[model samples]
Target: MSTTLANQQRSKIISLLSPAYLWLTVAIFLPLSAMLYFSFLSDVPFGQTEWHLTTENYQAFFQTTTYAKLLWKSIKLGLIVTGFAVLVGFPCAYVLAKVIQGRAREALFLLVILPFWSNSLVRIFSWAIVLRGNGVLEIGLNAILPFEVDVNLMFSTPAIVIGLVHSYLPYVILTSYLALQAIDDNLIDAARSMGAGKHTILWRIILPLSLPGLLAGAVLIFVPVVGSFMEPRILGGRVGTYFGTVIEDQFVAVFNWPLGAALSFILLAVVLVILALSSPILRRAQT
Candidate 1:
């Protein structure tokens, strides 16, 4: 009777989760599978999709130097933005986790997350307003420094990076704070008692312990930054096209669904490869 009851409980738990599993399989996996299948086929003339299996789409993607360059640029930009987010976010999170207390900490945490409540498009548009010709930022800069020349900030690579960093910085701060909070207080006290200074303790104890969160935040920033179309579309202007724009053009403007699907799968494959490469680093941090 005891064995039967245990088995029955297990079955009940599985039954409860079965609906969620089914939904994910249908909603997520099915579309991904369809994309994968379509990516293997060729595009017909006038934007028709043919089901015949061919590697031409993949070949075309690689053969084009511009596409390859854009992909590399996207990866580089994502990495740089992720690095900046971590650098800025780590100290802020450390302060929140270690220094603040009670209501004040709660208030600060709210402030950190409050920006996320607004629509991302609204925020990007605000940046556009500030950075455009003779806009708020330029006017303010000129007012402050009489000799300063008005700098064009909109439709530039730097503007896109700034926008991406703003969009994702909150995630880095939240993750780093969680990681820092998990560190034992005694470890820091032990280091201090051993005559270590604040800098030494931070470097030796806190930073190492907080690395997993840092890595998690980096991954979070990287994944989105690489695939981001909106920020680059609005801010990138004519400086250069990223892979996201290329994929978007194929799908929306050109109406080449098969080619677009192939490009998307290729992008997905690149992301998976990055994640796979980073798995060892993540595992090491955890251990």
Candidate 2:
């Protein structure tokens, strides 16, 4: 009877998880498998297009230095955006989680997430309007200061960074807030009672405790930023060509789906390797 009951419980657990597993298989795995298959093909096997299984798509990446440089550039962009997001978002999160309270906290929290309420395109264009030469930012700066200012950040790397950061900063703030919320106030009090300075406590206790959330936010920001084409294309102009834009061109402009798939898989592999290398730190943080 006990053995039968255990079997029934296992069956119930599997039943509960079946729908989610089915959705993942259909949505994620199936598309990834299709892409993987496409990456090994000479061309898209549709309509009158004659195609064959080939490794040239993958080989092309290693054969060209241009792809490597663009990929590295994208990786750098990801790191920069993630670093800025964490630096800015963490303080905002700390204030929200540990300092503020009641209605004021709610109001501020809403403001932090206010960007999400509007379309991203609107936000990027708004920044463009502000950052353009003789635009709001320059004019406003000139109005307040004695010195004349000329600010034109649009169509530049900084503009891309700003837009990406604005778009993704909330992820860092939200995750960091959740992690910071879990930290006990008593521990802080205990540290204070033991004569720990603000810096000491922050470095020795708070930072270590909140690392998982930081890493989680970093991953969330880094992964998307690396593959982002739209923001860079709009904000960066000629300077914005990265691995993502190259992949986009391969699909949209060049109609080279197999090459795009190969590039996409290479990006996936790079991301997986990064995650694997960092998993030990993530596990340590959770413990």
Candidate 3:
């Protein structure tokens, strides 16, 4: 009777999970499988798929120096932005989690999230206005340093970095704050009672404990920044191309869907490799 009951419970569990399994298969797995399958086909002359399997797309990606350079640039940009975000966000998160209280803390949290409510494109355009020649930033700079020529800031690599950091800053702040808040106050107090200096406590106790949040924020910011198209497209202008823009052009402009799909997979592979390399650090941070 117990064996029969166990079987029934197992069957019920399977039944309960069946809908979610089906959804994953249909929504995620199927599309990914289709993309993989289609990526091997050659684009037919005159805008048709020949449907013959070929490795040319993958080969071409490697053979092209520009693509490699762009990939490197994307990686560099993502890392730099992640560093800046962490540097700016960590202290703010610490303050929010440890110092502030009541409505003020809630209000600050709300303000951090408020930017996300607006359209990203609108925000980018606002930056464009401020950075353009004779715009607000230029005017302010000119007033401060009249001898120095006012320089245009829009459509530069720095502009793209600033835009990406702005877009993703809230994620880092929230994650870090949650991690900081989760720590036991008694542990910190104990360290203080032991005569640990402020810097020593921060470095030895707080930073080590909060590292998981730092890694989570890094991963969250890094992946999107590398794959971002809009910021680089709108802000980068003709200065340079990122990998995302290349993949986008392959599909939309060049009409090479297979190549685009292949490039997308390559980007995915790169991100996986990065995560794999960082896994040890992430695990240690969590512990």
Candidate 4:
């Protein structure tokens, strides 16, 4: 009877999970497997007489300083964007979670996530128009100011950062809002009743509990920003030559599929390492 019940349970579990796992195998695993195999090859095996394995694609990264420097630049850019996003998002989240109430809260929350409703490419292109030398921003500033001013912020690092932050801000706000809302108002009230100041309450009671959400948001922003190509290309122009753009060039311009795959795999490894390092802190934040 026990053996029969175990077999039935196992079958039920498989029945429930089979479709999702099969979908993952088809969608994600198979592509990654193909990419991995390509990363070790000398060239793409399409219409080829012979194909051979080579580690030169990976070695080129180490032998050359160019990719490494660009990768570091991307990392730094990610950090800057993430930092700004955190600073801007946390305060907005706090106001929404604690200060606002009723219909106002709902409207504002809608506004916060409204960015997601629009296409990011459209948004970035819009930013390009707004930041041009004699563009909307410059015209607006000139209208307000007595003196003439140039507002050519387009095709620069700050423009790239601005575009990225605009896109990623919603992620941080959503995460921080959820975390902040989950905390009990009673705990804050009790702290205040004990003569704890606003700063003290925030430092001791709020930040600790909401840390996981904040970190998760930061990770979300950082990972994608590090691998971003589109915004940088559109906004940064020549100054936007980072690791991601180079990876893109390998496949599109250079016609080196193996090198592109290797670069992509290396980036994946880096992202995994970052998550692994942060796992401990995230675990602690929950408790």
Best model per lDDT: 2
lDDT-sorted candidate list, best first: 2, 4, 3, 1
Question: How do these models rank on TM-score, best leading?
Answer: 2, 4, 1, 3
lDDT for each residue of candidate 2 in 189-245, tens digit (9 for 90 to 100)? 999999999999998888888888878899999999999998898899989899999
User: What would the per-residue lDDT of candidate 1 be over residues 158-237, giving only the tens digit for each residue?
Assistant: 89988889899999999999999999999899889999998999778898899888888989999988878889999879
What residue pairs clash in candidate 4, if any at all?
Answer: none
Q: Candidate 4: deviation at residue 98, Å?
A: 1.5
Question: Which candidate would rank higher by lDDT, 3 or 4?
Answer: 4
Identify the leading candidate in terms of TM-score: 2
Worst 10 residues of 3 by lDDT: 42-51
Give the alpha-carbon lDDT of every model: 0.88, 0.93, 0.88, 0.92
Candidate 4 residues 225-258, lDDT tens each? 9999989999998899988999999989988899
lDDT measured at residue 37 in model 3 versus the true structure, 0 to 100: 78
* Candidate 1 clash figure, as a count: 0
Residue 39's lDDT in candidate 1: 74
33-124 per-residue lDDT for model 3 (tens digits): 98887688876344453468899988988887988898888899999999999999999999999999999999999989977999999988
TM-score of 1: 0.91
Error of 2 at 152 (Å): 0.3
lDDT of 3: 0.88
Candidate 1, residue 115: the lDDT equals: 65
Residue 256 miss distance in model 3 (angstroms) = 0.7
Which 10 successive residues of model 1 have the least lDDT summed? Answer: 42-51
